[model samples]
Every structure is written in structure tokens, then in C-alpha cells.
Target: MEHSHGAHRADDIEDARIKDLTERFRQTLSTKRMNELVSRSVSRASSPAPRDFGTPQPPPSVSDAQLPTYSSLRNIPLVPQAPQDARSLRFKNMLHSLSNMPIRWENPGLLDEALRVVPLEQIYNEAEEESQILQAEAESLGAGKKAAWGYQDCVVRALLRWFKRSFFTWVNNPACSRCYSPTIGVGMAAPLPDEQARGANQVELYKCSVEQCGAYERYPRYNDAFVLLQTRRGRCGEWANCFSMLCRAVGSRVRWVWNAEDHVWTEVYSVHRKRWVHVDACEEAWDKPRLYTEGWGKKLSYCIAFSADGAMDVTRRYVRNVSKHAVERNRAPEAVLLHIMDEIRAMRRSNMSKQDKFRLEGEDMRENRELRSCVISSIAHEVSKLSVEDIMNGRSSRSRADPDTQKALEGRTSGNSEWIRARGEGGRGQPNPQDPRNRQR
Candidate 1:
């Protein structure tokens, strides 16, 4: 019985060793067996570590599906940005989107149709050329062209071009010639002699149409046509209308006036000279009484009541004396002197400054209107009292007469000695002899 127990224990130990040895052989022969054993042993000891999805995912790598791949945009040439000027910062916003902006027609909903029909480049080029031509023509006419016809032609052409598109839309009636003629006299048209019309004789070219036509007591009547040629003879209103009509007809500008003490007149803009010319045709038609002495010589007065440019009003008495030639030629002291006085009087009325008023008052007092009106009965009284030398020399009179007035009478005389002196010196100076400033200086 003892021998049998020892044999059983030895066999049991031997069997366990055999089982362990068999498991090791199995592991060496196959990976599945090794894994099963490892799994069973780890499970019995501790659970195997589990994989976690909570671990942060790495950033995605570039791939066909994730990346923006380009075949064309990458190859396009980049436009260089323009260097900005500091001073041009104001225009930055205007230019910022210019490159990216698509062309847009100014009229809404027009782009689709305009792009199809209009040649933008051709239209632009043509417009530029036309503007150039207009500029060139305007440049050709500089400041101060003395010729009236030249001024009229240029003004008319400009008007035609400026209003070309509006021509058919509106029309103005052509004015009658007689309605525009300058004459306050009431008389039939008695055409002047061919010689007088042509200004042939040394006699004054301007004579009252009524007088020249030998219309006794009938006087002269103004029509539009006569006013243009004789701007100082028409009725005040007629003269103004005629002058304004002529100027506006050819696209020049003019202003008309009818004040209480004065007759009608116009101020026409002279484009070439950049100044206005006064026109008072009504004043020119009065009869000028002729006066002559064998020794003193023939003295004529051109009775131009007002300057075409609105500078002064020639007195009615003086206007009846001179010939048209005397006026156009700048002859006749009485006419010029009276005109200066008229301007001075106007200045006196318009001056607002007390100092200016006081100065003008002193000048006005010297005219001796009160004393002369009491003493002098006739037109000749004032003129005859003035010595020929005084008239010619523009000599200042102290007998209650203004020296400034005297100087004005001498139209463009040595009183403006500096102008002549400057001319002699050949300086680029032009002193306006008519300017009161030149006289004051």
C-alpha cells in the first residue's frame, strides 16, 4: 500500500510537468497559441490596456480632397501695385477698386445694350479732337481786338457752335433795321448826299438827318438800322433796344437802362477787348449849331451824350454842335469835357465813403453851377468864356471851376504825363488815361 502512494504522487508531478512542456511547444509552433496564452494570462492578472479615441487628432495633412488645388490662377501674372503719393491720399478711395471694377455704363440698364452698340474708344477720340479744335480757335483770338467786325464774327461763330443742338428747338425773329436805327428826330428818311455818307468832306460827317434832309420843324425819327451806325441819335429807349438787339443777335451780352435824368442807352460786352462799350445813339441826332469866326477859327462840338461803354454822358447842348468825324477821331473838347463831368457826377452819386464824398464835393463846388446858371444865359457863354489855349492845353481853371474836370476834358492829355513818360521809357506799363486813379496820383 505505501509503495503504491509514492508511485501516484510521482506520476501526478510528472503529469503537471508534461502539461507545462506541451503548452510551451504549442506556443513555439503557432502565433495563435501564443496570443491565446498571453491573453488568458494577462486577463487573469490585469485587464489589457484599451485604446482611447479621446486622444487629440493630429492636424490634417495636405491632400487632394482637403487642399485647394489650382491649375490656372497660380500661373496668372500679378499686377504691380502703384507707388502712392502722399499728396494724393485724397484720391486713394477713388482709385482703390478701379482695377477690380467692371466697366459700368453711366445710364442704368444701359450697359448690356451700350457695350453691344457703341464704340467707346472711337467716340472718346472724336470728342477729344473737337475739344482741341475749339480750344485752338479760342486761343487764336487774344485779348483786345479793336475791330468791331472781328469781334462780332468770332462771337457769332461761338454762339452757333455752342447752341448747335438747340437750333431747331427754338427760333428768334430777325429785327427790323429802322426799328434799331438811332434817332429821336421825327422825319422821313432823307438819305444823306453820297459825299456825306462816304465821309468825304472836311465838314463834320454827322449832321442831324432832319436838318440835313432840310425837314423844317419835323425833327428826326429813329429806326433800328440807323441806331447801329449812329448810336447817339435815337430816342433813348430806341437806342438801348437797338444796341441790345445787335449784340444779342450775334451772341454778345448787353444791359439797357432808362433812368430819370438820362436817356436810354446800352452797354455791350466786347469779348475781344474784355470790356464793355457804351452806346447812346439817341443823343447823336440833335442839331449842332455851327459857330465860326474868321480869326478864332471854326469850332465844332460833337454832341455824343453818353459813352458807348457807359462811362459818361455828353451834354445835350454840346452834342448838337460837332460832326461824327470829330467824335470818332476824338476831336472836340466840349464833347469830351462834358462827358468827363457826367462821369464825375455819377461817381459823386455812387460814392458811399464820407472821405470820397467830401473830395468829390470839393471838385463839384468848383464847377460853379449856381453862379453860372445865374450869369450865363446861352450855350456859348460857358464855351466862349473858355480860351482856346485853355481848351487845348487842359489848363486848370480857378474861377470856380474844377481842375480835375478840366483835366478830364483834355481826354488823354499830358495830365497823364507818367503814361507818356513810361511809354518813352519802354516799360511794360499801360496807364489808363481815363482812370480817376491816374488823375489822383
Candidate 2:
């Protein structure tokens, strides 16, 4: 009975305290004061937000330190491939193998030996003259202006001329050792142990045309640029390999471009231009990206340029007119190619600084923009080039004939539409009635 009375007393005290607090709260919410508070709340809510004086804004985009890179601005997926299937794995392996070709040039002794065959004096003289002329021209323009082609560029140009006109020999067929007669093509032959040891992955078989002697000649397609320096003769592969090595020896950044169409060429980085400049040593052509498609009337699929520093797709560099000149890129999926590119890029740049990596990424973005512009500019040029008469006639103007044009036309005779026209291609690769075997520089 005593416990029950104490509990009731405690409950009564709690209720009395609650009632007192409620009455105090009610008094605080009285008529005029409540109205003033509500009006202030409404005004504050209805008014514009105050400026954030405490917070700092993000810095501007970088493009030469101006516009942000696409990758930086967005989180769009690159769609990289994981390569689970057997086919994708096989393709990845082959590309990895092909990627090793440029890495071979990194051997200092190999590059030194490759340069021994070059006429350094002649090349240097010509380069100096050209460089001086370019410098003078730039000076005439105004102060702070730059030359068209840098001194290093002129050196490569001079070396290219010397390489084509005087140094390297384009071998359509190896002269038979037995009778010294230019040999006729029999077919491809398996590489001999000696040839394989010397770095030939494939060999071409040729039989002497002479009736008296049936001597079979083996022309091993040596991939080694050092061996090429000694032989001084081969198809586009040899030309590009030897020339690119020499370019490296002469102290300019160079790339060996491999095409799926059995063509190969060189691209030297022109520091003056801040880009890779196209150079086809076989045709003695420079900066003519459309020469294969436009002049030779061919289409291209993959044009991969590999260097010691990196590898790039570069298909856009060569094939500007996709509708007319691009072959189906069916070797691998686009995502797989992107993945491969990323892998190679990361491998090459694994050791670089954050700032260096950022700079290169910026450079890559700029190059991509430039390449895209090429397609646009090419389309615009084609549209503007077409005359009313051409529209009526259904024909476009043809480029004038030149020495290179003749060679490019010769390359077209291969008639392998799935592939493309290139050096050591055309009827020259086969038994022709014209006997293009005799035509060598």
C-alpha cells in the first residue's frame, strides 16, 4: 500500500512538470511575436540564396594549359576488352609479337652499325643547306616565328633522298647466283635453319628462268634491320626497317608503320611540327597520307605505327576517306584494339612522372583532335573540289603524273582489293610481261 502511494506521487509530480513546460511554450508562441517570426521565415525562404564567399571555384581547362582533355572532363567508358575467347587471345599474342619489331631498334650497337652505310657527309651537307634556307625564310617572316621544317626534319629529308636515290635497292627478285639471271617467282618457301637463325620468319622461293640450269634461289625475308644494312635490298619492310633505324641513329624520334595490307613505312616525329610526319622511303614520298588511297586507288584497314616510346592505331592518319578508302577493321573488335593500345601505352609510360604522363595525355588529346580535323578537312576539300562540270560528268579531277605516281600506279597492278597498293606490290611481286623485276633504284 505504501509503494503504490509513492508511485502515484512520482507520476503526479512528472505530469505537473510537463504541464508547466507546455504552458511556457504556449506563452512563447503568442499572437504578434509568432506572426513576426513567421514573416521573417517566409522572407528568408523566398529570397535568393546568399553567395558562397567561403568556397573556392575549380581552376580552368588546360589546352597549352587551356581546355581539359576529354577523359578528364567525362567518365565515359573506354570499353576495353578482357580477351576470354581463343581468337582474341591469339590476336593479342600476334600483336604483342609485332610490337617487338620497334623494340629491336633500341640496341645501341645495332643502330650504330645501321648508320655506317649512310653517306653522312652528303646527307649532312644537304640538310644544312635546307635548314639555312628555312631559317632565312622564317627570319624574313618576323621575330619569334619558326621555320617550316626544322634542321632535324631537313636531315631526315636529305637522308630519305640519299636512301632512295643512292643507298637502298628495291628487290623485286634476287639475281640467281648460278647464271646471274634475274630469277622468276616459284612460290613461298619455308625458312631454312640458317635463315631462321638470322631472323627470317618467312622466305620466298625463286627459280632461275634459264632452261640450262634449274637453280632454286631462296630469298629469306629478314626482319632484322642490321641484316638489311648488309644486304642493302628488300621490299617495303626492309626499306622501312633500315631507314627507320638510321633515323634513330641520326638522333630523331622515328616510328615504323606496319599496315595490314602487307605495306610498311616510316614516320619521324617532327619537333617543329609537334607531330608525326609520314614518310614512305620506297616511293620517296613525304607527308602524303593519301598517296596510297588517292594516287594508287586503294583502300586501307589497319595502319599501326610502332615506336620504342609507344604504339598508335594511326588508321585515321592514313585513311581519311572512310566511305571510299577504308577497309573493314574486322581483325579485332574496336574495344580490343583500344585495350591493346592502353596496355601498350601504360607499359611504355609506367616509369614516367605524373606531370610527364599528364603532358603526354594532353599531347594525345591534341593529336586526336588534329586527326579528327583531317577527316573533316578532307571531306570539305573533296566537296569544294567538285566542279559543276564534274557533277554533270560524274568524274573528278586527277592528280598530274609524276615519278612517284608511276610507281604508285605500278603498285595497283597487284589487284588485291582486300589489301592495298604499296611498295614491292603490284605486278612487280609477280611474273609480269613488262618484267618489272629489272626496275630497281
Which parts of model 2 are misplaced by more than 4 Å?
1-78, 141-145, 382-441
> Which candidate number has the best lDDT?
2
Task: Mark the 10 consecutive residues where model 1 has the least summed lDDT.
Answer: 286-295
Q: Name model 1 segments beyond 4 Å from true.
A: 1-134, 138-240, 245-267, 277-310, 313-324, 327-441
Q: Model 1: per-residue lDDT, tens digit, 1-441?
A: 999999999999999887865665443334433344445445546776334212232223322354233434322322222224443332222222221111111223333332333343443454455555655666678754234323343443333232222211111111223333222323233435543453222211122234334322222233333322343332334334443444454345554432222233444444454433444332221111111101112222222222222223223222222332122433223323343445434543573567766754553354235324323443344455677778789984324442222311222111134433432311112221222111100
lDDT of 2 by residue, 282-396 (tens): 8887787766776665567888878776678888887876887787887777768877877887887899899988987876787788888888876776686667888899887
How many residue pairs clash (N, CA or C atoms closer than 3 angstroms) in each of the candidate models, in the order given? 49, 5
> On a 0 to 100 scale, what is the lDDT of residue 356 in model 1?
64
